[model samples]
Target: MNSAEKIIDRFGGQSALAGLIGKRQSTVGYWAKKGTVPVSWHGKLLEIAKNQAIDLQPVDFIPIDDEKNLLPAESSLPKATHWGELTIGEKEIPCYVLNTGDRVFSLKGVVVGLMGTDGGQLVEYLKVRALQPHLPSDLLPAENGEIPALFKFDTGGEGFTKYAVGIKIERFNELLRAYSSALLDHHLSAHDSTKIALTDRQLQIATTAVRFLQASSDVGLVALVDEATGYQYERAEDALRIKLKLYLEEDMRKWEKTFPDPLWNEFGRLTNWKGSVHHRPKYWGKLVMELIYGYLDADVAKWLKENAPKPIRGQSYHQWLSGQYGLKKLTEHIWMVIGMASACQTMPELRQRMAERYGRTQVQMTLYLPVQH
Candidate 1:
């Protein structure tokens, strides 16, 4: 194992280290890619290690730089001395984050620049409201000439140093956005939810799916299940979208109005088929979850064949289950089979895994299939 991996292992695993750094486990792995640690991250890792009772030093991560050519070209660039500047709408804000989730905005220089003329007055009002009278750590302390008074942020990273405070990776962009918005009105904006970055294909699939939702006054299980189907395969997003939309067209023909907020905004983000290396069809995937519940030639499929659906056009029960109904019935059977499977095991293992993955165990779970169509 490389030094980075070794450090991560000592903290239990990648996930533990990720939790400490307030980053995704995958993003943290990037720092340790190919058994090489990024020079920029060397100091950060050492500090984290020290906090965890593990001994690590700067030299343990990189060469001593006695000779210039020994290091890679990219490593020589000036490292980010602090948590770094965050860009929001072409405006850069100097900010600091602490392990305690406190964010200290550096209002020394840009106070007037960002807030216009009355920026200082607005900041003064926020100083008392977002006040942190007691200093939590030296990382983001209020310098004498700083803004009205330093305030603790609602969110931040898990480490802090004298010069800089670390901000959580997922929260960095959001903090910048909220801070900028707050300066305008002197009050924090609404919280921003983490959004998944989608590719072109995923965006198309989501966009097309929203149209179907928009066209329907009320939707059934099939329509909902169709949202995430066929996203498991690479390059199949558009094909699946086309097939599902055509199949559900007649069902959605009743209403031609646009989609509600949840369909367009919420489901659009959820249904993004971000099938890249960092993200895969692990969870929230109707097809993959179907397999986990034995939807493919297994108990759930057998149950679905025997119990769910009505025959159509003289086709076999299975053959009749096509398109939207097929997806809908498949989804219904998945939940039922999951319940039955858990019942048989007394399922200490499954229950524990469920609690770990989703905060709730089988006993605590409830299913509502929308009373069918």
Candidate 2:
């Protein structure tokens, strides 16, 4: 009998073969007509058929001659190793920017906490898009051009939004300043050497924000903050959203110069005395929170303790004091903000990104602090 006849005899023909393949007779006929298995997995299909205990048919047979006891030929096409291709919208530009000195951070806490997705998804995302060269080759310099930092994205969950971005940090010092400022902003305290009132949201964002502090030989503070916040913050004519950042040198200096300053002069310079103002800038909040609480918590704190006052502090000019400790709190809060800036590029990401990032550690300080008599 010919191959057709062999098929007919094997599994009692087309109808029986359909049951063996777990497909309709029509599908079997269609595959036969198509003259091949769906794609390159033809070997798997045949193995499955044999496993099902279906009587082998001549037509289903693959001619692998045992002449030299050789194995099947290997494939040339790239194997599907990673989680497939990373496709951002064609129109969407994946490139983000950072200044001279900026820090990179993690979004693990906020991303996993709020988004309900672990670092796996984020890792996959980074493997594809972020790992690729998004920045223009000419733009990246030979020596000090490429910014040192990390990038990430968060597709929000538990009532949150989705967004992505890249960030770069110059050194640990920059990270500390930003984190400290963020912490100060979050506590809603004006008792620093400098006196100022921060809005509730500002305080939250400043305190809890997570960030990455890229450690390297490079110097300069540059953070590339991006998100899906549209162009509202740019004051665009047709912007769909609006982002506002307030920079207050006067406020920073006033607080920094307050009596019994616990912060070093450089700390004061970094936080309060800077000539420029970056007081506040609106961003996609959801993404920001994720990056902060999710990503950079450990590094930021580690750097803070190292650079912040030592021997803790007690209470007077003769010894350690409240203002000094307050300075530490303020530093953490600001650092949180800097982290938030990297993570948060949109408003929705801001809400919880700020809350959780700040909320996590804020309770410890506020609740446990010794009251001044």
Q: Pick the candidate with the highest TM-score.
A: 1
Q: Count the backbone clashes (under 3 Å) in each candidate.
A: 0, 77
Report the Cα lDDT for candidate 1: 0.38
Task: List model 2 lDDT by residue over 42-82, tens digit each.
Answer: 33444655886755421232122222322222222111111
Candidate 1 lDDT over residue span 201-270, tens digit each: 3233234333433322132343355467842442332333333333333332111111112222222243
**Which sections of candidate 1 miss by over 4 Å?**
63-373
The C-alpha lDDT values of all candidates are 0.38, 0.32
Could you estimate the TM-score for every candidate? 0.18, 0.16
Candidate 2 Cα deviation (angstroms), residue 324: 34
TM-score of 2: 0.16
Per-residue lDDT, model 2, residue 355, is 63
**CA error at residue 296 for candidate 1, angstroms:** 74
